[model samples]
Target: MPITNADVVAVFSEIADLLEIEGANPFRVRAYRNAARMLGELGRSVRTMVDRPEELDALPGIGPDLAGKIVEVVTTGSCALLQRLRKELPPVITELLKIPGLGPKRVRTLHRELGIETLAQLRQAAEQGRVQSVHGFGAKSERQILEATGRLLQQERRYKWADMEPVAQALLADLHATPGVHRAVAAGSLRRGRETVGDLDLLVTAENPGTVMDRLTASEDIQRVLEQGVTRSSVVLKSGLQVDLRAVAPASFGAAWLYFTGSKAHNIALRKLAQDKDLKLNEYGLYRGKQRIAGDTETAVYKALGLPFIEPELREDRGEIEAARSGALPRLLQLTDLRGDLHAHTKDSDGHDPIEAMAEAARAHRLHYLAITDHSKRLALVHGLDADGLSRQIDRIDEINASLRDFVLLKGVEVDILEDGSLDLPDAILGRLDLVVGAVHSGFDLSRDKQTDRLLRAMDHRCFSILAHPTGRLINERPPCDIDLPRVVRKARERGCFLELNAHPARLDLSDAACRIAKSEGVLVSINSDAHSRLQFDSLRFGVSQARRGWLETGDVLNTRTLGQLRSLLAATMARGVGQ
Candidate 1:
């Protein structure tokens, strides 16, 4: 059977990680890493390139050796050298290589002297005082291992976007304040609005690159300066985030920023467009026959390619170039377009504010309405409301609405999407609410099929007005559940259920790609803050950015409507679906 592009990318990634553990040349390791990234981002399968070795070799960072390996893997399901290396190496050693500080040499020492092969064995050895007695291992190393083991056991395998947002924002702010820095902004994963960032990148424009590097290397926030030079500096922050800052002249600032802000796949597509026109694009500027043009702004760059300016979020090289060239880029939603927030908590649950205070805050924000979506009865730890509590809350909403002339407060509940695909609240309770946001708060490790079924069943509930933070991710902390998003999106559209672009900096759920896929499948999105406090309303800006990246229009979002309009839509949505 032909393997997927995902499988090919996964194999290459594992190989790259193994090579790094072996202390391979940094550039060689990077080449494989880049190849893996490119393969993962590719729309076509690696199998398609097997017949055309030249085509594969022509791709960025894929040299003869790498290209040959691609062919070998596609043809034989494995490479001789990779297979040999894996066979010769104990699986425990290979597994141990994944630990952040442990490298091949140290791994060899542990395996040979301490008989430590697996993380479990290593932990045992460290606990038994075997590892600390080794030549280089010490108390500190043992402590680090213990901490890493604790962290690994406590969380899922992948990080979420929410966990990385503050780190990226703080670092960018610090870099901007550094003396001699003319301009600075985050690029790469953070700029692309990824839910989880592998590393952070900052593009800086400065008069004296050397001075900028000096200041960056000496910054207090920097845990260690990984690499420094005139044009670029890479530092690891105290939070274990690797941030790369590159400096360029003012004249090339825009170009450099765009280049560095890239989803690399986007840049490659842009370069291809330049190639077709006999032009060259680089960090300096766009060039036609050695003549520089369009370097001052991203708009100019896109105009030079005869395309409309693509939004940063949309520049994922996923049909964006084609959409821009065809003058068909969707009129994406913006923060100012939102009329209300659909998912908010109050003192009725774990939220700090009372229902009246939450409503007043919404009025202060000039929002048309706010939904008081406190936790449901199932989440007892969070003071989740039972049916009686929800009924009382509705009466309070009526009183608040009666008291407030400027804004409306909607009765809403963040009901739990239970195991086996049932909702925490029944139709009798759900039917009384102005809005219902179905969400997964626990049992997140369900099989993909089961998770999807659970969400679909939730959407099938007539009162499920929206699906909040569909993936239930907290950036850099939790990986998303294994549910198939496309299927959920399709079901949502069919059922007139809105998918939420959760606005919490940590959640940013319905990631850019997932948002795009949802929009394409015709599911309406509710750009919700899922706010617990008034301060969190600002997180809606991040959601808007994500919506724009996904090509969501104001009309595509439920919250873009006025209070009356939104209420009408909610009623319409409820009337169509089967009751719980």
Candidate 2:
């Protein structure tokens, strides 16, 4: 099996986790963590870069040592350092890190203070009331730990869509190459642009179904074949992801695609609509008294039921049917509609690339402009800029912009929003920037009202142009802070500011539901890549997908505006703070 970027990411991440638990050098641990992140968010294939040592070495945060290990893992499907660490540790020590509140520091504390290394051991300690006695843990902490352990145990494994993409693409390529196959594509939640997917549903049209099944089962990636049949087959990959493949006749390919690409609720609604029309719908075709009427195309299928073609991302039964029937479905936002990315970083903060490299990359991606929103000094670990540093950066951006032709580089900062509803940077410093991207880096445990108010106060700042990653959630790694997002969206409208639909796969904050709320309240959202590296510009496509899922149109996205229009809107926001 070919080693995927996700495979390499997992190996590197494990190495970092184990190193952290072993109390190795903090910088050493951070190196592995950073490399894992860069590769995970990279748009291209790391596996294909094995032969180019210089290219691999050039990746941000990947020095000679780390680059060698990446090449090792990609070519060998294993890393000796990771293997050795696994053997030296308690084997299950890494499992403890999955619990909600347990970071490496907390895991180290648990392992050293109570000899708890496995989930079972940790759970027993929490249950027996021993964990609360630890230095930082209390009764409430112990209770929460127990609850988190139980939740982890019961949760079904779901892979992020970004992680599953390469695997899915590889499988599609294999199926397409199979002699008898004519068409192959993935369906189900993966097609719906869902953030996380539980399993894959693949549809294929082939001359010989048996040959396609043979090709699938013979793959090196398969862990085991669950079942094999003439028309259908199921297998589990070594990565623990289950895949189901169905071979449909060419005539019914589109019907099968629609049936399998379902949100079960969406399918049920469609079926009811078909029934009301006295038509029959199924995997085979839409029929009238045993005569096939529509099946060869999804558009044909929807048309037969007197509705227009619905985008797959909006097939969530979230009023889509009613909207379609009333000719009110949104012309959803597309990747092409995005004109620029407003939130990004450079080496000035914790980002990997230099300012010039980042700007060139944005231009390469065809963006008319890019914003350099590095961290503020409050985030000391990233060596965030102070007032003087930001002032210098503003000057540097102006010089760079002067030298460039059509592309402009905007000066900006991802300033921290302090717990008391104040910004980390002074008003004087903030006033100099083209825009301000406010973020909450700590204190996620605040009450809903407090969190909402915190955001409201930050938006009230004169220079606040956008709220970056509004909820401060990191997908599976962290829960969204308790905040009333609707109120925050309303506040943005009143303040003439915008909310960011942060496009990082790990933090797709201002989630679909939040985007819908923003649209309803007439608050335009900026779909930003939040790119730490140039390669991360690809993340904007995923952000666009999320926006479509939220029923966002071109007009609902702030970044779709040209640079000139964006400047006018931003100026209005800057002036609104003075009067309001």
Candidate 3:
């Protein structure tokens, strides 16, 4: 199999983690980390780009040295540096970093002081109450560690949605190209747009099932073929993602798709409805007295059940069925519904692209406007803007806007919300921008009450426009900080502010449940790509899927509005006084 971007990212990320545990230079470690993130989010494949070294070197944060490493990873599937680092460290030490709240420094402390090298050892130490005795760790920290370790031990491994995309695409393409295959489609939680996917389920219609099975098992990406048959096959990929491929007759394709693309709860509810109607529903077909009534299409099945067609994303048994029955199902948000992207970054902050490049990219993606919400000075690592920097950028935006045609770039700042619920930039500076996106970059361990109050106070600010990445999570890497999100949604509704559904694959914050809450509270949600680089606009698809899962319609999203409509809404929030 060709080296995928995800493959390169995994190698780079592991190297960075091991280097951090080895107490390597912060700059050196950060280089690897940034390269990993960039490649992971890069739309183009690194393997295909290897012939053009200049393109790799031109990518932001990837110097010639890092570019060479990427080439090496793509060419050889593994780099010498990663191998050396893995050998030098206690192989499993990096596993310690997987626990929430335990960064490299803490992992090093535990390793050096207590000889803790594995989760089993760490758990034993914590259970013995010795973890708190270490420096920089208190009883509370120790307790959290214990609980996190326990959860990690018991949790089944699941891959992030983005991580599985490339592999899934490759397999689907191969299936479509197979000689006897008629159609192939991915289903299950993947089709539902879940944040994380446990396993992949693929359904195919083929003239000859044996031909498809043979092609599937012959792929280089298949690490192991657990089972292979004429009609069904299961395999584990090189990345450890399990894939199940099933061949169904064309007549039964829709039934199989519906049966496999289900939350167990959703399937149960659907079965009950079928039973109530004296009909039988299964992977074969919907039947009455052994006579097939509907099966070839999902629409026909739903219609037979006396309900409208429920979108795959809304098939999570979360009131979607009830709504479908009552003819109240929402027309879920679509990628094209967004008229603008309200959160983006540039070299002004940690983003790779320049302001002009980002604007061009958004315009190319069919957006009418793009917001340049660079980080504020509080996030020192990103070279975030101070008051003067923001002022200069504001003037720069005015100059660029004068030159542009229909598309416009909005002057904005992703200002940090301080611990005491204050804005990082002054009101005067923030008041000068098109919008202000308040974010929480620190104090993830704050009590739920304090965190909620912190966000509430920030939203109450006269200049606040939206809350960015409200939960502050990094998918499987870190848990969301404790906070009352429903309360925050209600507060936004009350204050005329909005909440962000950050579309970055790593931080799909303002989760599906939160989006539903915002919709219920009548607070518009902004589905932003939070594009740090140009290609990241592709991430908006994931955000749209997340919104669909949350039951968001075009009207429920703030960015779905036209420029004039959006300006009016934002103006109301920006000019409002406290408690208004």
Candidate 4:
């Protein structure tokens, strides 16, 4: 099996987790964590650069030691340091880290103070009321730990779409280069742009099935070939994502894609339509019994069925059929339609890049405008802005704008929505910006009514323009706080404030369902990268994928507007217009 970037990253992450539990050097533990993050965000597989390890050393956080470890894990399935740590600590020590209330420090405390290591042990500690005896844990903490353990036990393994993206692209590029290959495309939940995916399916048309199958089995990332046949093969990647490759004749390519690129509900609907017309639709082709017809392309199949072609993203059978028949299907939002980003941070806060560099990067991405909404003072850990700091940043933004052509930086702040529903920064400072993004950085444990009311109160604030990562989810890491999302969306519409679909892979908040609800409520959604650095701006495409899955159109996204339009929109959120 070929070592995948994800595999190497997992090794580093596990080392970091185990070392933290062992109370190893903090900087040493940090190095492993940073390397894992760097590898995850890398645009190409680390395996491709294995021959020349210097290229790996040249990456952002990768030093000689980390580079060797990368080559070590990629060359061999595991690393020696991780092996040593496993011997030194309980093998299940890392499992404690998955609980919601447990970080490295707390996990260490649990292991050292209570001799707790596995999920079972931790659960016993929490349940028996012994966990609260630890220095930092309390009765409430014990309850939270117990709940978190239960949730983790019931969860299934899933991969974020962003995590799977680079790997899939690399494999597709390799397949396209295979000798005598006519075409190859990845389909299934991935093609439909699901936020998380279980596996990948590749459909190919080629002259030599044997050549494609051989290449797939020989790939370094293949952990094992579960099954291999003349035209179909399935393998599990080193990252545990299953991939199935199917080679078909060019004539049935479209039919094969339709059959495979399905939402089961959507496919059933299509088949029912075909049956009504005395036709049969399957992987081979749509037929009037024994004679294949309308199978050369997706457009041909849709045309024969008397329905407009639906984009793969909308193949979820969510009223798309009726819309297609009525010619009411959306011209879904595309990445190119985004004019700028409204929620981003810089070095002034916890971000890695400075203002000018971030603006230049945005210009490089062809964005016409960008907003620098660094965190406000309540997030003291990030050295978030006080009034004076925000003022300085605003003046700096003006200075940067003077140096650019066709690109501008709008001063903004991701002001924290406090527990009692107040803005973290004073209105005097917030009122001066092009926009203000309100977010919930803490208080994720509030009751549904309290949480919904908290947000509703924040929306009543005159400077509130957009809600950032509304659900506050971290994918597989944390669950969303209890809140009436529907009420929040309706209130945002009435107040004219937009909701954000944060593009960051960890928190693709205001999820597809929320996006759809926002659209139905006639509220606007802003697909922002929430980028902390210039490289993170590249994550905008992930946000676009999520918006497409939500059936959002260009007109439904607030940031797709020109700078003038966006400014006019934000102006409505100011004090003077609260009653307008």
Per candidate, the number of residue pairs that clash is 9, 0, 0, 3
Estimate candidate 1's alpha-carbon lDDT, on a 0 to 1 scale. 0.78
Candidate 2 lDDT: 0.91
Report the lDDT tens digits of candidate 2 across residue range 1-580: 5788999999999999999999999999988999999999999898888899999988888888988998898888889999899997865788898887789989989999999988888889988999999999999889989988888778888888888878888889889999978899999999998988999999999999999999999988789999999999999998889999999998898889999999899999999999998988999999998999999989999999999999999999999999999999999998989889999999899888888999999988989999999999999988999999999999999888889999999889999999988999998989888899999999998999999999898889888899999999988778899998878888999999999999999888878889999999999999999999988999998899899999999999999999999999999999998421
TM-score of model 1 (CA atoms): 0.72
Residue pairs in steric clash, candidate 4?
1-220, 2-220, 2-221
Model 4: lowest-lDDT 10 consecutive positions: 571-580
* Model 3: pairs clashing at backbone N, Cα or C within 3 Å: none
Question: Model 4, range 1-580, lDDT digits (tens) per residue?
Answer: 4567777888999999988878889999988987787676555678889899889877766789888989898888799998998999876788888788788889888888999988988888888999999999999889988888887777777788887766677788889889999998989988988888888989899999889999988887778899899899999986678999999998899988998999889999999999999999998789998898888788889888999899999999999999999999999999999999998888899776789888988888899999999999999978899999999999999988898898989989999999888899888888889888999999898999999999889888888889999989998888898999999999998888889999888788878888999999999999998877766777889899999889999999999999999888888766433520
The model with the greater TM-score, 1 or 4, is: 4
TM-score between candidate 4 and the true structure: 0.92
Which stretches of candidate 4 lie above 4 Å from their native place? 1-8, 42-80, 90-92, 113-117, 120-142, 575-580
Provide the global lDDT of candidate 4 against the true structure. 0.87
Q: Sorted by TM-score, highest first, which candidate order results? A: 2, 3, 4, 1
lDDT by residue (32-103, candidate 1, tens digit) is: 776775564343456778898888876656789988988887776667767765775654466676554677
What residue runs in model 3 are displaced by over 4 Å at the alpha carbon? none
Candidate 1 backbone collisions, by pair: 159-476, 160-475, 160-476, 160-477, 161-195, 161-475, 162-475, 162-506, 163-475
Scored by TM-score, the top model is 2
The segments of candidate 2 whose C-alpha lies over 4 angstroms from its true place after superposition are 578-580
Model 2: which residue pairs collide? none
TM-score winner between 3 and 4, please give it.
3
lDDT digits (tens) for residues 160-279 of candidate 3: 887777767778988999987889999988888899999999989999998999888898878999999999999998778889999999888888899999988899999999999999
